[model samples]
Target: MLAANIRTQLEAYLQKLEQPIELAASLDDGAKSAELRELLREIASLSPKITLREDGADARKPSFTVGAAGQAARVAFAGIPMGHEFTSLVLALLQAGGYPPKVDAATIEQIRNLKGELRFETFISLSCHNCPDVVQALNLMAVLNPGVTSTMIDGALFQGEVESRKIMAVPTVFVNGEAFGQGRMTLEEILAKVDTGAAAREAEKIGAKEAFDVLVVGGGPAGAAAAIYAARKGIRTGVVAERFGGQVLDTMGIENLISIPQTDGPKLARALEAHVAEYEVDVMNLQRAEALEPAGDDGLARVKLAGGATLKARTVILATGARWREMNVPGEREYRGAGVAYCPHCDGPLFKGKRVAVIGGGNSGVEAAIDLAGVVAHVTLLEFDGKLRADAVLQAKLKSLPNVSVIVNAQTTEVTGDGGKMSGLVFKDRVSGEEKQLELEGVFVQIGLLPNTDWLKGTVALSPRGEIEVDARGQTSVPGVFAAGDATTTPYKQIVIAMGEGAKASLSAFDHLIRSSAPAAQPEKLAA
Candidate 1:
């Protein structure tokens, strides 16, 4: 069931185990259980230090326990552990075998000094790319603190529990029986939430109220750059972002960014935050911008957040980025994170040595094909257009890859998969009436980009395609307001370009401040 290379990696990781670990599975009599047990047995055969045990049948749901010999298991996973979640399972096993947590000293100290019992119940899906980070962090915390117990609940496996808890997304974390967080979060961020009693407060009421000389409205590369540049000026700068990394978080391999030969999304995101932290910028994360109010006569613009908090600023820089376009085909939503993935950088590892397909013929799609070809067994690139729209250089690179194949004038009809996971895709030939099916394990959709400018519709001027309109200096249609990055009418949506635009916008805002504050040329007293 495992690829030769992936199995080699797993074997190496297991060899580092400090002690023997057991996998206890509680499963019902069904095909899913059969498949899971088969996979577990294969994993067990990989290393003599590992073993598997059945915990009897359970009609409600399936669960698994990971622990060393003669020790009660404090870590459990309740799901299939497929797709991206496979990484979570591997990391949990390592933790059970005495792999120390990779957290900083301060965070480890906080976990060690905790006085009361804390249980982290993280709801997840096999397909979620960001879920593994939270799961691994929580599992490490459980290993560090005897008072903490962590469990990974596959949201799809326990439907009743998920509905009872009102979970609508993966990586929904609960602490001490209270909803703690949702989506990708760092270990420090989770600790802060727990310390501040944030879980007890209504989700919509949790935010900070502040005023700033400059406020950035997104957390992607552009927003982070703007915040850093603004703070360097020694002003009271602030940034409010839904997620600090923006689309960069979704990118897999970033090779075009100057100087940085190769880096992934999460790494770049952390670097962006580290740079911003060097200044006095007040970063409020996981806060979505609800509305943008233009500066009044007092020259203070107000930004309303979804969490019912308002931030007032002398200048506002809009760096809200773009999201990947979806195909809107059947089974796309049902198998999201399972077989349908958007960010190749986040989910590519899961499909190592496996066959996958990419939808689109543009630069993003061709680039994804080229990248995946190096890791996966094969990459099938499908384009709806009559001809490939990517640059000649990219097309040549794609053609040279033996594992990569391009298909044009192909219209994807449906994403076919089992009730639980995606199996393949069906597409129709636009030129002929022929239909074809490609049996692949994963699909990367890179058709196009859609700006995250819905909230700025009436607040700012937008181009026909919904991108923010900005001048060369990054100034928006409204004075004291500026925009940059993918959200703007920029020709390219690249990390370096976004960072440069952000710098330009912040400098423009600074210039506007200086010019507006300067005393207007005094009118002649005689004229008065």
Candidate 2:
């Protein structure tokens, strides 16, 4: 109910008193002047809310409180919030107009395990409009939860405060006195980190609903993509995964994806998972799905969690990506990152100009051989089969590299390494029945990949290898069920492809919803 000019009025009152009076000189001045000063003082006392304090060299500390509820909900700007940030800051404060952030079902679920507070402070230049959707998104997050605050401090106006915090960037953010986020954000990422704050504070009040709509069983590219799209589409999505990001998260760099020239898998996954908050997707980290069941006519399905909770979904999008098949040989597990690697695209740079080996001669193996030959001093390609299963074009490419030599009909029974890194491999020639050893700095295994659809049972159609079977549009055999990314029998497992599939499935599900309602299937006529 306050007017917009109140700040101007208060500032006018304070500025008028800027005149100085020396303590030494007593201006036991005129009665008229004294009477006027007393009248102004009495008028100020009418409010009974104004107080004087010293801060800066003048010892001036200018803080004024007027809300009936006191200063419970405060937007303290140590510096001015100007430029594009001005509107965002005002909107954020108005949205979170009450104390703490608002708490919603989705927001509460993530913060149920929270036991502490997170104070987030974002430093921004008045000019960083490229910052993106986080400011408003963060305000919405605070509105849904308690004890979470989002503030955008204009670093330029408050140089002293900025210097005290050692701020070096335009949009640097801090959570609990440490950095939470920087640069542009899409709301969900900000919520993700803040929810982590809520989770830490209210660790015991999570609630009764543990289930979710889209139970993304894994946390790889596909699962993360599915969660993001489903949440955005207003689906009551929940993610149950052993981890947040799957094997791709372990990757060092991803250059093949579009838009971004290069990014580490873990960083990308973190950003993507944060994007899930756009529509309130619930995430159950460190948990796994154990089973699934058809919901019959409801067109919905039920997924059983490892912790015994059941999730219901009108439509299920299977995005539980795939992983590399392991060697299971001695020293293989022990020296994985050191010497044994699954994806050359992830770790090839570490072996530059040094001897390396590519295990298996399938498409993946050949591709790895070709990629590694560009960086390594030598590459020995091994295959247990009689010949390479790679395409003729790729096979020619691999052979063209002088550093890469292919060995067919080879079997590796053991691996030996040092200092948690691999150094050599012992193999047996399957055709000649002779054993041989190769010394190398790195080894890229590309035998095959296993889809993570083992727990899906026979509730849905699946490929022979247990990959979920879905149509080109990511639809499963069931009407409401959909599948996407690597879990499905899709040809490619790239990040962009997974995200594209996720969005397509969400749109398809929305279309299906528009149909099958009580009003029947009446299509609206187009406007002339």
Candidate 3:
């Protein structure tokens, strides 16, 4: 059954609909089908302009074709779209009912002018917060371009297809039957994959020149910030990232970014790219930096990308960022996308009214518990330490929530799950030597972060924990090279902190450029 609050929200959105939308559902006879049909009926009933037709047992599983009256079905939702994906369903209905997309004109133009057929099949879980962004983006693109069509497949219901595709994560997108990317992605990123010719043309333009005044590695918040700051200085700046937004793409709700009260990870990531786009930064996305070579006195620092393209720069700023620490328990890997999730923000909604557990007693774990408590029915936070390590303020906030409970001196022993999905978690009391099992649908692991500095092992001075060693000004051990964000020895790993560090690192790199023997150029004019 739909939550009252969510139903209210959906009704409000439906009231704004100007055109009629037709939803043709192909459902088999089962409890899952019955539930999905009821949910659709509820949604259709809310809006006088919406219509639902039962196609009956035509598909192997529950599927629906959504479009305006007399129009070809341009969008499809396969499986139940609940949890975080409810938003996607609502958005799809809105767009089908004559609501325009919110994409930038540039991206829209790109989509409008796209050639060839693009079939995007996005496999997603109802609980995944990140999946909605990608799904909505692709859905909008499909609406904008006749050449493109997208289907949102519920990974949970379509277990056979999920297994056949070997989808290990939510929001696993396939472009033309090939895996494009897993996790959250922006509209621009999706377009880049569909328009291969455009990407190659852009790459050829960048490959013609190999040197830059400042080359900022990574595309997360720190790297994006660094590239923008460096490019604003009128220098030839370039950025190489396997994907823009780095670890920030995996994040969900960001409330402490200053000024902005609250923003999700995908929105913030798009904003970061939008800000960088205002400048002349040469952004090379989908490129990985395999190795880094320090400048030999007179020569520029060389960065070797996985594509064999070598970028030479007078100054290099490392902002690769970090990844989440895994618990390494049994079934943790077996059921990654199934039930064991590391991001509470992305997957919390999926477990609505269901019991869940949060591992680790740090600020992240406490914050996750506090957040999940609001969305889920109950939250059990397990800490390995004798006492929680989170700040007193956070601890107090977590204590104030009635739905959340904290368990200390407990070590997660195993993530017990059915072959297809997670069922519960097994834990052991460190001191009491007692084992316990918590029946929960989801588990969020917020133990800690591991910096993405493994590739820079011998090239730079790294801390014992593998973070790049940097001074206050963001200067690394090597001259003309700087590091910032979670990848560095920065104490805190907040978004605002990473942005500040990125700016500092860019300024430091600029200072090094001016003091060095490189050609002197006016600050107002960009290097040619």
| Winning model by lDDT | 3
Global lDDT of each model?
0.81, 0.61, 0.84
- Off-target runs (Cα >4 Å) in candidate 3 are 1-71, 77-128, 144-148, 153-169, 172-182, 187-206, 352-355, 373-378, 391-405, 416-428, 432-441, 520-528
* lDDT string, candidate 2, 1-528, tens digits: 113474455434434332221111111245533443343333244333333121212111121111112234322333333445545543443343332343456654554444456566666655444332455455454444456555555554445665566443445677778867654554545555544544333223222454344556676777777777666655467766666766665455589888889876656877876776555777766556778786566555777666555666666667777778887788887777556777575356446567988998987789889977887799999898899999999998887878888888899887887655678999998878899999987788888778888887677789998888888777888677777777888777678887788677766655555564411112331000
TM-score of 1: 0.68
- Output the TM-score of candidate 3: 0.76
Q: Write the per-residue lDDT of candidate 3 for residues 412-525, one digit (tens) a residue.
A: 999997788888999999998999999988899999889888789899999999999999999999998999999988897889999999999998998888778473346546
lDDT of 3: 0.84
Worst 10 residues of 2 by lDDT: 58-67
Provide the lDDT at 304 for model 3: 79
**171: Cα error in model 3, Å:** 3.2
What tens digits encode model 1's per-residue C-alpha lDDT throughout 255-335? 998999998787799899899989888887777889999989777899988767778888899999998788998988887
lDDT of 2: 0.61
Model 2 residue 361 lDDT? 90
